[model samples]
Target: MNEQHILEQRTPQAGRLLIGLYPARYRDLHSEDIAATFAEATEGLNGRALLREHLDLASHALRLRLRIASTDPAGRMLAGTAPVALALAAGECLSGLLPSLTALATTSPQARPRLFAVEVVLVALVFIPWIVALLLTATGRWRRARPVAVLAALIDLGVALVVLGAYDRAPGALLRACALAALVLLAPPDLVDTGRRGRWEAVAVALATGVPLAVLMDSRVTLLGWSWYEVPAMVGFWALLVVSLLLLVHLSARRPDRLRALGIALGPAPWLLEYGIGATHWVVAYFVVLIGGAVAVGGVVHLVRRMLGAEPA
Candidate 1:
């Protein structure tokens, strides 16, 4: 055929190749419509115009693939869990630092320098990789983030093991074990494609859950050593936890992915351990009880909805 006829024929084939990059289900649903659109868009185009059309097609295909992947339940779960894990780790690091600093302050001047140096090294080992992994995950670089997160968890577990050997404390050891489990669960081997919106939402959830707890811990508000206002504050904290757990359960049920549900359920474990075992705070323990109650309530809600043929909240 003539050059124009040959170019027109080739353009549709190129468009098909680009569209093939989409997920199989997506292609099955809309491939014909997409191909027709592509052919219509590229009609009479050649040289630079043709090149620009192909570039746009390729870019659109890539974006569609990413969007589909990011919406997967497993991927969303990993994205949601990462920020919460990082917040817990930051809190643990800060708690450890305070005691180390306090002890170092009382040491002799020469001994202080040596002790402080050790603390600095330990802090670097504990925090740097975890922080880098958090940044990578937040920015939607999941392929790189997974390995870094795993490395951070390994280093943390090693540090915890060393501490357990030195101190032989059950509570501290148990907390570390729980933290390690959380990190492992959050960092699945497969790349989790979380988009910008998912990353930001995860961050917001983490901050909302963690900031208040940090404030309480820093202010030393314990149930045992309660002030007049502390009783009301404890009740408020318990209510918040119950509401949070109910929301999490509702969201998880809607997604219908067991891993996502489990990840969200375990999101509070580190904080629970912090208050329940490590710090032994009565208020925190009571909050844990509220979580259990919320879970039971969520179960009843789910059952009622199912019976009524209603959608999960």
Candidate 2:
């Protein structure tokens, strides 16, 4: 490490790109220091070591920008929500699995073994790894869980490429797989600590996930005649509707844990996103009403607080 060499490596292009991922204000103040430190730390690294460093940097950058950093109460709320959200996404997948599999079986018989196998592989890639990650996280083994989830995500990407090459379309499961993997990996490891409370959260998430799975699988519970997929969306919409209404109450009441409650309310974000991606007319309306209603209520509350001299000048 001569001075010239150090200088050149001190602000490597790759490091600068990563530092750019930070918020604009933060990057302006700290990008030079951050890039210099990263370059120095990674000078001799290459191959998997270099890739790992890049992934870690990118993951942390995302966590900070997303408010899931694990240092603040709000971040802690998201960290706690991560595993539960993953479970809920997996449950959504499971809710539709039988119908999907049955359809594949009927359609692929004797003529499309390759396509059928690819689909099954896609399902396994998304579902099994997520379940394993959930189990690992639930049992307080985040160190193991993170790597497992990441590897699964990589495989999903690779399979997605192959599927696209062969069929000109990627599997739909890829989106959910990546979303859950990001949730598992970007979550601050320290925020989801091991202990009774951690175990209880995992346990509750698992049991709640099972309820949707059972109901969707039964086919007898179609009160609204909603499809298997729509059932979960309906369930999630109502759940969020209730949470948003409760959030309005908490906002008025000035509850201290309101931020945490908001985080919990957002736990269904992964499921909601999947639904929104290909939602039908009614489904889109459900989303709009919930989101619009929440925003309107929050605005009203803010105006009331301002009028009452309850808010700061």
Candidate 2 segments exceeding 4 Å error: 1-16, 23-50, 62-73, 94-116, 143-186, 218-221, 224-232, 235-258, 276-313
Ten contiguous residues with the weakest lDDT in model 1: 231-240
The best candidate in terms of TM-score: 2
Candidate 2 per-residue lDDT, tens place, 80-146, comes to 5565665554444455555666766677546878887877876777567756766777788876677
Candidate 1: list runs displaced more than 4 Å: 1-87, 94-111, 166-193, 217-220, 226-259, 268-313
lDDT of 1 by residue, 1-313 (tens): 3654544464577776888887788787876667767888888988756765675566446645665234456555654454445544543444444555565566675756776788778767776776676567678665555455556666766766777556544455457445644444434424333677546644555445445554444445565786424443342343336345634554436444545544555555554553455345664655566655656666776777878888644
lDDT value for model 2: 0.63
RMSD after CA superposition, every candidate: 12.8, 7.5
By lDDT, the best candidate is: 2
TM per model?
0.48, 0.58
Candidate 1 RMSD to the correct structure: 12.8
